[model samples]
Structure formats: C-alpha cells, structure tokens
Target: MNYDDRRASPRYPLRAFAELGSSDREWAAHVLDISYYGARIALLDEYNLCAGDPIRLRLEIPEMQVPEGMLPYLHLEGTLVHQQEHMLGIQYEPASELDAELLKQILANLNK
Candidate 1:
C-alpha cells in the first residue's frame, strides 16, 4: 500500500508514558510518535478528548539521557486536533524557548 507523508517535520516513534488533560481532568496515555509541532498518544484509559479542545501534555523523559540542565519531563499546553479510537493528536501551542530547545534535543537523541 502507498501512503503520502504530509507532515512538515519528521516524526520519531517513541513509546513513553504521558499525561493529557485540561485543568479539570487528566488521563494516562502513551506517546506513540512525536515531533516538535505535535504528538500522537494512545490512551491508557477511556476519555472524551475531542478536537479543538485545549489540553496540557506532560510526557516523561529520561533524565540521564536528556541534554544537561533540561527537566525530566516535557510539559506543554496544546490543543486536541484529531482523534482516532484510543489515540489523540495534539498540536502544541508556542512553548517556552527552553521547551523548544529541549524538544529539539530530544528528537535528535531519539533519531540517533
């Protein structure tokens, strides 16, 4: 089967625990793939995460492997842009300068 790749930035496959929610709700999820712009996460539990809804993402990162001085988690605010069954697609908002650099470093390490 043939598939078209429409992503502006390449995505790296990563299996990591993550948290997705709003101020009032949160759910356990596993990150399947990630890029600087967004990520695709599989829910560990049932929830109603819909497109256009604001959400916060907290993804666990290995402290030892990350660039020095970076935190052990990726925390960002985003919007749910798509969903399929148990997976939710998140589009991250403009993040802090540090967060952006950390994401770049993380992606580089993942691809190594």
Candidate 2:
C-alpha cells in the first residue's frame, strides 16, 4: 500500500513559513502540506534528522486572520516520521484544545 494511504485524514497544501526546533537546534522550514495528524515540510538548510526525533514546530500562516490579542502562529509538537534530504514528514502528538481549535481555523481558511 502507498504510504499516504495510511493517513487517517486528508492533507491541505499550505505555502507558509515555519520554524522547526529540536533540543537546542532550530531550522527554517516551509510548510508543504498539513493534516490533523501531521505535516510535511521542507527545510531551508540541510540537517540530519532521524525518524522518531521529537520536534517542535511553529507555523506562520500569513493568510489566516486571527482575533485581536491572539497570536498569528500555531505551535505544535510532533515526531519526525520520514525524511528525504531536506524534506520531512512529521506526525503530530496529541494537541492541546487551543492548538486543535487553531488548526481547525487554519484548515477552514485554507479550504476557502
């Protein structure tokens, strides 16, 4: 079976900037696509990452409007599931309610 067929939810293509951090390291990345369960990203620079490595991702979705006093970014925790050169597939861990709501809002805007 295809690897994508294992996904439980559909992915939405998103052209946005993001920061990916693990331990003391951080790298600039571009959001390729996202789903409720995970995301695929391309790093701006080459970096060695193995599957199952913990990663913290902060996505800056410029097209998504947010209410006053709210941040315009989404913070998420995930694990690197696959890698090919500078591109990586990440599987999200369980999210907080706030993060989950924000993800829903982002997806809604993307579907428009």
Say which candidate scores most in lDDT: 2
> Relative to the unseen true structure, what is the C-alpha lDDT of residue 90 in candidate 2, on a scale of 0 to 100?
97
Question: What does candidate 1's lDDT look like per residue over 1-98, in tens digits?
Answer: 32116556888899888888886899988999998888899986878667899998988886665777778887878899888899788889435787
lDDT of 1 at 29: 84
Error of 1 at 10 (Å): 0.6
Query: Over the stretch 41-84, how does candidate 2's per-residue lDDT look in tens digits?
Result: 99968787799999999988675456455577888998999988
Top candidate when judged by TM-score against the true structure: 2
Give per-residue lDDT, candidate 2, residue 2.
82
The list of candidate 1 runs beyond 4 A from truth reads: 1-4
Candidates in order have lDDT scores of 0.81, 0.85
Clashing pairs in model 1? Answer: none
